[model samples]
Target: MYKDFGPTKAVTDMTLELKRGVVTGLVGENGSGKSTISSMISGVYPPTKGTMTYKGQPYSPKSVLDARKQGIQYLTQEQGTIDGMTVAENMFLGEEESLGKKGIVNIKKINARSAEILKENGLENVIPTKMVDDYSFEERKMIETARALSHQPEILIIDETTTALSQKGRDRIYEIIAEQKAKGTAVLIISHDLDEVKHLCDEVVVMRDGIYINTLTGGDIEPHNIRQNMIGREIDGSYYRADYECSYDEEVVLEVRNLSVSGIFEDISFELHKGEILGIGGLSECGMHELLKTVYGALKPSSGSVILKKNGVQLKNTTVSVKNKIAYIPKDRDKESLFQATSIKDNIVTAALDKLKKGFIITPSSERKMADKEAANIEVKMRDIEQQVRDLSGGNKQKVVIAKWMANDSRLFIMDCPTRGIDVGVKEKIYKLMNRLKNEGIAILMVSEEMMELIGMADRIITMKDGKLSKEFERSAGLTESTIISAIV
Candidate 1:
């Protein structure tokens, strides 16, 4: 398949085959055309050249609905559910004709049917009559999956869906994929997570710069080999921090005491030491993300307090958090971090507005200089600081986000899934940057889903389960994935 966006070739002459009863993993860096290929196959976009054959016949779909009618469904990376609509409404969005007569919809019957489907798929608590917006992110993901499975698709394209899911949700998806394989349904999974791809896929196809590089099967489908093929180079063994000793100061920089967010998280108390990389690991819905917000004072906790002591002053709210030089790197960088339509200069200078002011007015020259310095510090690859961040690749955009904090010279950092969709090469740079910040006595509270990352980077790891701290592991050579998984599950 070939696809081009004006002068740029998004995908080039990529020939591939998905065998029946097999799960083919697509591994690549962001902007490498993995999602593009999956989107093309699911009829989200039309290929500029090349043809696709299904069941030994020419297959060309005009739209997503057209593809779904032919037993092909795609679960996109972003949230697929409509906000105002009910679960039943979102489930049968395009295929509403089956539940309606002469344009008159049968809401009660359709909802009943939807409820049944939800119950069967282990989503009993999700009411079909309730609006999708009322549900959690993980719940909405399950709804999208249920909708896809409703089509009884012969070919399923799951694009980076597991990243947003908790352990229970991911296990459900695995079960669905296993069942689909048993039914001889072909599955194509696009993921940055090599461990997930290795565990679920029968074969792995590596892509780079919109071109197919290599394919691995059986014994060749290992994490190191897949990483090498995807990036076209061998990564160093010490990609993460090599030292196991705790390098943090004994003095507490930030303290959370008996913090409770109603039903989300209860009595969550922890102390972050100066220069510490305090890692928070949990399932997606374990309230870790919410805890980050609460600590930042974005979400008001029902009880207890978040106290950030910096420069002998205490931070009590969002305003205080900002004034005290605390920075936040949210999980959704596109929505929370970068201004998509704005220039890279604007993004970098956003957090450092006070520093950019010349007398009474904020000078353009000051902004440019600050942006340039921080961008250079983080090694952000862009044409110029004037370039719109939306035009940059995922890694570059992320660098721009981090550059803002660097410009602010933040003392405390709260990062949630900082390297979620980032490629291995960029991940290494971010890891190095985090270590550098720790050495500079900047306390960091990192909330992440990747187990290996926590083990490799953290001075102390705290595992949350059912809105509570389940286990805590100090940095040591004896830390293992199995030990962490036991606490998580």
Candidate 2:
């Protein structure tokens, strides 16, 4: 398969095969054409070159709905549910004829059938009549999964779905995949989580720079080997920081006092010291995600305050936060961090607009220079800085997000799942960057669900459970995954 978007070739001469009764894992760095190939297969886009065959027959789909009618389903990384639509309406969106009679829709039968499907998939709490926007991100993703499975697709493509899900949600998806395999369905899964790929896939194909690099099977399906193949180089043994000593300053730079966000989190109080990486670990609904938003002033807290002290001056709310050198990299990078339709240069210079201003007016040359400097510093791979951010890969988009904050010279960084969908090569770069920032006396507050990451990179770890701080662990040689897992559960 070959796919091109204007001047950029997303995929070139990529060929692969999926077998029924087995899961085929597609592993690649961001912008590696993994999602592009999947999109072509699911009829989201027609290939610019080459042809596709299904069950030994020529296949060309005009649209995603057309592909679905032929038993092909694709669950994308982005939220696929329509905001105002109900669960039943989204599930049988285009295939409503099955639930209606003679040009008339039967809402009652649709709801009844949708409820049965949701119940079968262990989503008992989700009502078929309720609007999808009323549910959480995880719940909405489950609904998408349920909808895809409802068609009993012969070929199912899942693209980076597990990164947005918690362990419980992932387990449910794993069960569904297993059930599908038992039913002789061909599964094509794309994920940056190497461990997940190894666990769920029978064969793994690595792609880089829009081409296939290697295919791993049997004993070759190891995380280290997969990383090596994906990046076409050997990765360092130590992916995170190795320093065990406490180098943080004694003075607290930011303080959250009795922070409460209605029913999300209650009485959440914590202190971040200068030059420290404070890691927050918890389940999906444990309020850590909301806490990041409240601290950044994106969401208003019901009680308490988030205060940043610098040079004896107090800072609160987003305006002051930005002015005082505070930066936030949200969990939903696509929706919250980067403007999809804008250029990379525009996104990078967005936060640092004040720096690019000459007197009362903004200078385009100065903005371009600043954006170019930061983009080069982060090594963002792009044809040009003027390229649209939406056209770049997930990893490159994230680099642009980080470069924007770096350009602003942020002192205190609030990062939520900073490395969520990035590959190992990019992850190493981020960890090194964090270490460099720490050495410069910049404080970082990291919120992530990865236990190994917290244990490896955090100077101090705080675990939350059910909207409250469950336990705290200082970085030491003795810190283990089980020690943190106990608190998270």
Candidate 3:
């Protein structure tokens, strides 16, 4: 895929197969040819020296429609739906000619059909008429899934699409896949979420540096074995942090009282101390994401205030929050975080430009040095810092986001599902980085969908249900995932 851009290969002589009525998983590190393989299968690009066949015939799709006709749907990692359109508008975008008369869009019919489609697909929370922008990052992601599913394709190719979905949305699509399997339709899922793969996929295929490593089935199937095959080495035990220092003064770094965001959440209040990792977990519709965004000042609160303190001092507004040592790492990297097609160095160093700036000018040499150091520390596997982040792997892209925040030296970090779509190796580094930051007296407020990650990494865990803070746990006292999960609902 990168042969024209540079004298490098994205995938070299790679061959993959998916049997009928089976779910096949394609796993690899960032820039390890997972996306490249997905592109070739989805007709985004053609292979240089190989053929991709379906069933018993040689098949090649020149465009997205060609791939779609062959019973293939691609939920690309990048934004695949139009941003300005409503959820229903994007859902039936291409096939709207049937509903419209003389190419004139019929809003009434479009919305009705969209609602029907989503309802049929088991997505009831997604409003048919809501503007795509107003929906949260994860909500919009489910809308994308609904769009891909509008065609009812036989062979479903979902690439990193489930990271943003709530458990309900995820279950809806998985049920559809199960139905398709009964009808003898083959499914291909490309995801970094190992738990999903283990549950959904019957067989697994591992790829590395554009080469086919091995395919594990039955007895050969395990997360560790798959990881070792993909990275060609044994990995660490825990993805969460290890080197943490629990010794810190009992100084409160943040305090919020009787905070409420109208219909989203009510009576939201919490206190955060310096050198503490606070985690929030709940079901998909529990409003945990809305609460976190409000804390970061990304979303306005109707009657709540976020107070940031260093040795007990309240900071001012949103700008002051970021300027006075607070950073918000969004839940959706493609939408709110990294810029695809931009260089990795640019993504990493964009947040730290204030440090590299003199008046209005940026120092390139110093910026490069800082970016390189951060990337190295995070173990970002990239050929060059100048390489575009779009072509990098999911795990590597996440590391770049982490590197960006670390470069800025933010004291209080508000992260929502930061490790949603990354591999185990990168997840471990993130845990280590969080511990390092907490040890340095940096306060972290994290919201995650993964219950185990919250239990393993968090110093204190908070549970939200119906947009209200219902329960809290102290990890210092040794909390269990079962206890945490039980409290969530």
lDDT of 3 by residue, 185-243 (tens): 78888888776788888899998877888888886767778888878998867666553
Pull out the clashing pairs in model 3: 30-393, 31-393
Residue 457 deviation, candidate 3, in Å? Answer: 0.9
| Alpha-carbon lDDT, every model | 0.87, 0.90, 0.79
The ten-residue window of minimal lDDT in model 3 covers 1-10
For model 1, state the Cα shift of residue 389 in Å.
5.5
lDDT string for model 2 (318-384, tens) is: 8878888899999989888889999999999999998877789998888889988999999998878
Task: Please tell me which model should have the higher TM-score, number 1 or number 2.
Answer: 2
Q: How much does candidate 1 score in TM-score? A: 0.90
lDDT of 1 by residue, 79-134 (tens): 78888998999999887878889988888879988988888888899888898989
lDDT score, residue 105, model 2? 87
Q: Report how far residue 340 has shifted in candidate 2, in Å.
A: 1.5
* Distance from true location, Cα of 449 in model 1, Å: 2.6
TM-score of 2: 0.96
